[model samples]
Target: MGFREYRGSRQHTHAHFVLTGHTSFEDEPPLLEELGINFDHITQKTMTVLNPTKETDASILGDGDLAGPLVFCLMFGSCLLLGGKVHFGYIYGIGGIGCVSLWCLLNMMSLTGVSVWTVASILGYCLLPMVFLSGASIILSLQGVLGQILATLSVGWCSLSASKLFVSALAMHDQQLLVAYPCALLYGVFALLTIF
Candidate 1:
């Protein structure tokens, strides 16, 4: 027997890649945008993760909020548990909270223009370091307080790097980093709690 079909329309010959898992930040908004407030543009931009000006808008974080981070966390957290940290979930959870907080703070501070997506972009990309911090905290546990600080520092440094790109994109004064550093520190504290 053969899998043959007589298609009456062009649609019958076409396959939806999304149904087969080829979907990415690039494809979700159009298909799932109707599902809710889809921020596809914002989410895709996060993949690049730079915002150098006030006009750098990252508010369109795509359709599924869980889409990007879930893949990242699963891989990182599983590695941590394999390395013997049974509390790996804490890393995943705290990283998520930090991104949400980043989004909220950017909106409140009036540092960004346009919609809330730009912050989403910044945090989404920044979370990559948080994943590393999770692994570092687990591996560096033998180093005590110094290792913990270093791991947290990695997360903070990541945020600062993103902030610098964001400042450049937004064309803001370099002094705006005074605001950026504390925000990054707050994100670091969230990551810090995971290790300690």
Candidate 2:
């Protein structure tokens, strides 16, 4: 048998015992007696211990990988509410769907232990084509060369900002509060461009 003692404040004192062979609680008496320790006044009480094998379980969401999606959902949901009243149909529809999809992917990946960089790269691949398409559409919708250039730039900024948000969300699972921060800033700039 091996013994270790832990000292702390008066409220708690801990002792750890390591046994080399099988022994029962009843066998402790002789060992205690030999060690000049007494346990006559000690009382037995019920105690419960919780052990978790999976790191992604619901109980560990905030401390685990699930924090990424949880934060993304909240940020996107708030954006929807704010933009909804303004009748920004594109923001409410396509943007909302994209954010929700990203959130779902994050949740699934949390259980799978997929790397955040992989998630970000996949999202980039999916969004890159759309970025090109949106830019082309904005250019074609404009009347003059200058107008086409400005519109393309504006749409490109919006798309790039959205892509950055997805990347940020995937990379920083623990810091979800800023998941949509980049998107929101870009959205504000896009709104200003639309007004001008």
Tell me the number of clashing residue pairs for each predicted model.
20, 0
CA lDDT, candidate 2, residue 193 = 30
Measured with C-alpha atoms, the lDDT of residue 85 in candidate 1 is 57
TM-score versus the correct structure, for each prediction: 0.52, 0.25
lDDT (Cα, 0-100) at 45 in candidate 1: 48
Give the local distance difference test score of model 1. 0.55
Model 1: lDDT of residue 20: 62
